[model samples]
Target: MKKLLLAAALMLAAATARAEDNVVKVNAPPESAVAGETAPAKASTIDCADTLGVSRVAEVDTAGGGEYGEQYPPKPLLEKGEVVLTFDDGPHPEFTRQILDALAAQCTKATFFHVGRMLKEFPDVARQVQAEGHTVGTHTHTHRNLGGASMGQAEQQIESAINIAEATLPNGVAPFFRFPYLSDPQRVRDYLAKRNIAVFGIDVDSFDWRWRKPEKVMHNVLSGLDKTGRGIILFHDIHGSTAKAIPALLAELKARGYKVVHLVPKSRIETVAVAEPTAAPAPRRRARRHRRSKR
Candidate 1:
C-alpha cells in the first residue's frame, strides 16, 4: 500500500513538472496556431508562453454595485496613496534621459517598459535607468501589435526581447513584459502566463496617439490619474509630445499631492514553485527547429 501511494504521488508530481519546466518555447508557436484561427482564438486554449501574475485589485461593476477582481490581495498603488506611473516604448537616448531627470528631481521612481531594439542601440541608457533605482521591463523586440498577430509572431517578438533584456541586464535576471500597442487580447494574456511573464494592461490610458498637443496630453493624463485611485498608468516614450507633456503632468500630480510608485507585477514564484532553475546543461548548438517553419 505504501508503494501504491508513492506511485500515485509520483504521477502527480510528474503532472506538475511540465507546468514549472516551461523554458519559453518561443521559436515554436503554440499548437493552437496550427489550428488556423479562422475566428478570434479564445484565451483558454492559447498556451501561455509565460504567465504574468498581476494581482491588480480594482472595483469593477458586475451587475452588483461593485466587486473585487484581484486574484490576490494587491499592493495598493502607493504606500501613501500615490499612483503607479509607467512608461513604455523607450530607452530612447535623449527623451528617456529627460524623463529620468524629471523623476529624479521629484525624488520619485517610475517603471520604464523598455524596448529590446532600443536597448541594443542605447545600452547605456538602459543601464542609467537601472542605476536610477527604477524598474526595467521588456516591451518586446519589434513592438509587434499582438492583438491580431499570429501566435508564432507574438512568441518571437516576446522571446527575442527577453533574450536581449537578459543579455543587457545582470545574471539571474528576468524582466517583466508588457505588450505593444496595448494588446489586451485574452489569448495574449494567457500566452504570457505560460511563460511566467505578466500581462500589464493599463487601468488608465492617456490616448496620446490620437493627438499630439501637450496641453491635451496633460488633460487626458490628469483625467486618468484623477479617476484611478491606483493601478498602471500608460504613456508613450516614442513621441516628442509625450516627452513634453510628462514633466508638466508630473508637476500637476505633485501639486495635487500624488506620489509616484514604481510598479512591478507579482509572479508565480511568490506562491508556489512554479519554476525551478534547470541545472541541466543546455544542448550544444544545432540548426533552428520549428514545427511550423517560418518563411
Candidate 2:
C-alpha cells in the first residue's frame, strides 16, 4: 500500500509540472514565449528600416491655455536634442499628401494646424492627418491676422476654426491653437485662456513659404536648429518645398542624434457655437436735404 501511494504522489506532481509548463507556453508574451501563437502587430509598428520613429509622446494638460515655444515663456516643450515638428496652414491636396507619406516613411509624427477654410475644401486630407495619428489644431478661419481684428472678430475667427476642425476630424481637435502669423493680441490671448486652448509658437521657422527650393528650406531649418539647439520647428504643408524637404530633413535630424517628440493634448477642448459679430444699426435717414437741394 505504501509503495502504491508513493507512486501515485509522484505521478500527480509530474502532471502538475506539465500543466504549468503548458500554461507558460500558451500565455507567454511574444518577446518571451518559446511556443505560442504569434502576437498581434504593435499599433506603432514601423518599417524595419525606420529609425527616426517618435521618441516620446508628451501629453500636456492645456488647462488655462498657457503659451509655449521658444518665443513664449516657461521654456519650450522639449529638452535639448529633442524636436517637435509642427506644420501650419495645411491640408493642401498635393503638398499635404506628400508630407504625410514622408512622415510615414520615417514613422514620425507631427502637429498640423489646419485653417478652417482649407479643411472644408480638402477634408479628406485633414482626416488622413488624424488617421495617421498626428495631432490636429485650429489655425483660425481664413487664417486672419488676429492682431488687426477687433476682439469680437478675433473670437469669431478662433471659434469658427475650432468648430470647423471639430467637425472635420474623426477624434475631434486637440486643445491647441496657433495664431495666424503668430499674431497673438492680448485680448485674443485672454479669450483663448478663457476657452482653455493652449497656444503654440515656433522655435525655428523653416521659412519654406519663402524658400521654394527644397534644399534651401532644409538648410534654413538645419541652421535654425543649430542656433536654437532644440525646440518646436515650424513648416507649412501647403508648400511643395516643405513636402519635398521632409524626408531629407527627418533623415538629417536622425543622423544628428535629434529625437522627435510628438505632442498630444491631455484633454479635449469643449467647443461652442461660432459667434457672429453684431452688425452696427443702420443710420437714420436725414430728415431732408430737399430744402438745400432746392436752393
On TM-score, the leading prediction is: 2
TM-score between candidate 1 and the true structure: 0.61
lDDT of 1 by residue, 103-140 (tens): 54444556677876787788888776665545676776
- Model 2 off-target regions past 4 Å? 1-49, 275-295
- Candidate 2, residue 31: how far the Cα is off, in Å: 30
Question: What do the candidate models score in CA lDDT, each in turn?
Answer: 0.52, 0.72
User: Evaluated with lDDT, which candidate comes out highest?
Assistant: 2
